[model samples]
Target: MLTPSVEALIQHLADGKFHSGKKLADTLQTSRTTVWKSVQSLQALGLEIQAVKGRGYRLTHPWERLNAEQITASIQVPEACPPPVVEVHDCLNSTNAHLLRTASLRPAASICLAEMQTAGRGRLGRNWVSPFGANIYLSLLWRFRRGESLGGLSLAVGVETVRVLRTLGLADLRLKWPNDILWQERKLGGILIEAITESQGQCVVVVGLGLNLRLPPGAADAIDQPWVDIRTILGGGSSRSDLAVPSRNRMAGDLSSRLLALLNAYGSEGLTPWLEDWRRWNCVLGRRVTVDEIGQRYEATAVNVTEEGSLVLRRDDGRRRLLAAGDVRLRVRHDA
Candidate 1:
């Protein structure tokens, strides 16, 4: 968490322009020493701050902030749908972790976001590299009754995220089942769904998403897999400074709105409404993949996904099997 003074100070430098110490202190009603300390703090958070001795301070790249008000106003929800409770944080251990712990307190629905995550997480015990203000770290919470199926909820979330990106004119987007986003066969982002099923007839679902807008310097080295960000997607091999990105605030607004709709209708609708679109964006289907389950690995061709959300595969032995809990990975046949 950043202090109010530091937060205010960053805004002054967000325009990617230099601000003199005296000017910043006057604007913040603080002292030049305080302003210098604030700039040091921002730099510690992995932000590239340039201090040109006499030119004052400037962010290497203009900062794009996540504003709760801006996001809320961009959402197009109806009276019955009432937009979700959107909360933005300067830093958090993890958005999903926070929402899961607090979902009981706010049972209706909520979306949590962070400019930076101190302990960002990914599926299967992976570490998601989250640099301050470089990517989208989001978690959305929804409550489901017992009778309403939680099956395919991850798939639903992934599909909706792909839809949102596609609507923004992002092309060649592909969704890997359970929850991985891909663009041109390189990792774009991923989803991690965590839930707590109560003894009663209720469940709390927290879906976390780490969408890469642009990674900071050296951040990509921490990633284990080949990945690409939104900058590469629409920029077409352009330089970082020259790349033009779609309004992140609008994307956040549309993403939450779509997910809320999916959650609201999922109970009654199940996977029926999302089946077609899911298939449209799916890249795993008809691919020779390895399914890892219960300490065993089986090489099979993915045949289809059942209505209940189970993966169906045809083994190399010419037998079909239904997989409920397994991690599927693409095999020899590389995609274009």
Candidate 2:
């Protein structure tokens, strides 16, 4: 229930104009004192409202906030996700590190989102370039008990991420071997799932996801391979800085919901339901590939992924090898 003066201030901020106190008061048919009080309240709510003596208040920068209230309001739930105890941070070293530090105190379903990640990371200790203003940089914390092998957790998350992406109309999104998501031949996004298991019998997995929303300027130089962004998937009339996607908010809500459903489904139904979906979107199958684990390299023809989540392949000598875990690199085929 904003007063007329408060509404006027909001409009002025959105319009990016410098309105004096007298001008704001006249626009709202209110006194200058009321206008000043209203501006004070917005500043209290994490807004960088810069005040000037001659001019009036102005926002320091454009808004890129992902508030829970906004996200929850944007979604219509089929079955409500376990309402994630959401934590919003202006900056962090890495959401994964934050989650791991507070793991014991954290509730079962909690999500940590950072507007800027100072030290975000990726699989095999790769540096994830998480710029301040562009990307859905977050980590989700979920727990499992003793004796649950941590192997297929990344695959499970990959399935869930694809489900979310499919809802956004990217139906042809494919999974590249381990956890990279690809559209056509370019990389879309990647997932990293790291776990901590105690000797007694408890496990906690921090699932970290880095999705390219809008590529920041000069960001492509850092990436060594083919990459894609949301702007690339959609057309190119708009500027990279413009946050005009109507469904962006909805996608966030959908991601949270589907992730919870997948977590619950995995606990109850196991990974049986997701096997076929993975096969349909699998990028490594039928490709010439090399599996590099530790310092050893094994070259094989990508044949299939087993029901137990191991990769099954036939070598050049017409022999089969089952790879339990490794970095799979796809080689170019002359036939293509």
Candidate 3:
């Protein structure tokens, strides 16, 4: 957790430029010693701070902290729908957990974004790697009417994400089963959904997303699986490679708008409308794959996903299986 003073210091240094301790202290209305202490705390949070005797201090890499005003302005809400209430945090254990814990108090159509997550989570209890200013960590809270089924909600979210990325000029993006976005067999983002039913029969769901923007070398070392970030994908051709404030604000706003639109459509039409779009982005369809479910593993050829978003797998013995949940891994075929 970052104290107010530490967060202030980080904001002052967010431009990735050198700032004298005295100047920062003056701007923050604090002493130089306090600024130094805050800098030390930020370093503990995995930030690389470069301090020089005469040149002052600057972050090793560029970073633009999320701005609530910019993000809200970026989203284009329909006239009939109320705009989502957006909250930006300096740090949090997890955006989804926070929203879920406060589901009762928060209104429907709320979104939370954190610059850094101390305990980010993925599906099936996996640890999501989230480094400060290097990824997008966000959660959206939505309420569904009684008896409404959220069967293909995650897949729908993936489709919307792909749509937004494609609009931003990313090609060849694909969707993995359940809730993962991939680029050339490398993970680019993931989704996690948590839902609770209220006494009135309304279900509140928190849709969490973590998308890699630019992973620092040190942060990349912690990830066990192959991964890709937007910076690498853009190949220095786009301004997003710099991770500037304006670029981040634009990307965040674009994503939020697309996701909100998708949720609105899903509420009205369910997943049926998104089934064809999901197939367009499906990467594993017709590919040999391995699925691990409840401590058991099975190898099969990936077929198509059902309209309800369940994966269909065809085994060697001509058995077709429907898997509602599991961890899927693309298999390398020796024969190929």
Best by TM-score: 1
Clashes (N, CA, C under 3 Å) per candidate: 0, 0, 0
Give lDDT tens digits, candidate 1, residues 145-241. 8777667878888888988988777888888877789988788998888888766758888888899987766778888888999877787765653
Residue 5, candidate 2: Cα error in Å is 21
lDDT of 2 by residue, 1-336 (tens): 345666567667754457788888888788889888988866643345678999887765444456767665544433534556767675788989899888888776677877667788877777777764457776888777776655666677788888887766565788876778887778778887777875556788788888877665455568777887765676443554244432444566677676667765565466667888888888888888766766777677888877556778898899998876545444424253
**Quick one: ranking by TM-score, best first?**
1, 3, 2
Q: Among all windows of ten consecutive residues in candidate 1, which has the lowest summed lDDT?
A: 327-336
Model 3 — which ten-residue stretch has the worst lDDT?
A: 327-336
TM-score of 1: 0.91
**Looking at candidate 3, what is the lDDT of residue 286?**
85
- The whole-model lDDT of each prediction reads 0.82, 0.70, 0.84
Q: Over the stretch 63-144, how does candidate 3's per-residue lDDT look in tens digits?
A: 7778999899889986556668999987899999999999999888799999899899998788998887768998999888
lDDT of 2 at 24: 82
Clashing pairs in 2: none
Give per-model TM-scores.
0.91, 0.75, 0.90
In order of lDDT, best first, we have 3, 1, 2
Error of 2 at 40 (Å): 24
